[model samples]
Target: MSSTQLFRVSGISLLLGALISLIAVLLSFFVNPSFTAPPATFQSPLWSTHYSLFFTALALTLIGLPALYVRQRGQRGDRLGFFGLLFIALGTFLALGMAGYFISVLPMVAAKAPQILKATLTETSFSIFPLGGTLFATIGTILLGIVVLRAKVFPSLVGILLLAWAVLNLLGFALQSGLLAMLVALLSTLASAVAYGWVGMILVQQAGVSGEAAYQPQTALR
Candidate 1:
């Protein structure tokens, strides 16, 4: 594909990812009333909705990876860019795993105690999944952000935001508190939206133009 086409595809991927994430954020509140409240207990409806959104977001974020791969492969910075792609893949998997765990557990919990929506915090089958998933996703996003920044394939601002998001995610994990983690997660989501939006706008502007016509790199030979 031409450079313009590649960019357009990447831009579309980013926008889709952003849209899915936005939906997930909105669904979180409706699916689980406690989502707005302190993370005291998990509710079936809420957990279900959360998992759905998480998975959808994961799918959207991942859709862009291949485009990035095709653009970077065989290029000057293949090694670094490839590694970044790997990180994004890993993060996406972890995020999915987190969502999967929640989805699996909600049914069982609901079946046993349909009436009791809230339960005390305790070690359960579902709890660990989010923890692991969040960890991987956070790490992956951070790496992807760095790659984007270094590759200069997209705006540097997006990379910076990704880096900041990763740091926030790590901080949230370190705290091991729900409210804190959610807050950090929110920051990450916001940063992602901004980054994606920027990429989309750039792509739309550059569409139908050849890469050479749009971006001309200076070579040392010159």
Candidate 2:
């Protein structure tokens, strides 16, 4: 397929991913359990649904990353975008692993071995995966923001919003479970989805632009 066609498909993937991710975020309060909630919470249909949606978002986001990188790389010949893609891939893979673990494993744990969820697992891999995902994702996003800003292929605001979201996420990791942490998570997730959504909308719009337009800095933004 043509480059513009690729962008259009990638754009749709990212746009849908962002919208669904936002829905999952909104559902979190009602569906996800508090840190102190009982292990049986895992069995809730909503919990599975929430993470399932999140998993889909991650997958789509990863699929769209190459197109995002392509725009930057083709314009500037920069290796930074590749590194950004690498980190994002690592983080997404780790997150997907955890989500799959929850969707497939937790229900059984809740049904058969409730204590495992309450005690050992939480203190171990469960803790590690989120921490690692957060770190890698934050770094990846920051690098991406930098490349977008430097490349000047997409909107300057795209980079700004991405940086903002990454910083908020890093701060949330430092916060204890509380109102502040929840707010940070909500805002950061929103910023990320909006950033991707904005890029996707622009990509879809530009799908008919001449391929030469891709070589022009800020053409997509214009």
Q: Which candidate comes out best when scored by lDDT?
A: 2
TM-score: model 1 vs. ground truth: 0.70
TM-score of candidate 2 on Cα atoms, chains taken together: 0.87
lDDT of 2: 0.81
Instruction: Give the number of the best model, judged by TM-score.
Output: 2
Off by over 4 Å in 2: 33-36, 210-222
lDDT of each: 0.63, 0.81
lDDT of 2 by residue, 1-222 (tens): 777988888889899899988887777777543434567678889888888998999898788778888767766537878888899889888888878887888788888987676775666657767778888988999999998898998998999999999999889878835677767878988999989998888887778574657658676568
Clashes of 1: 2
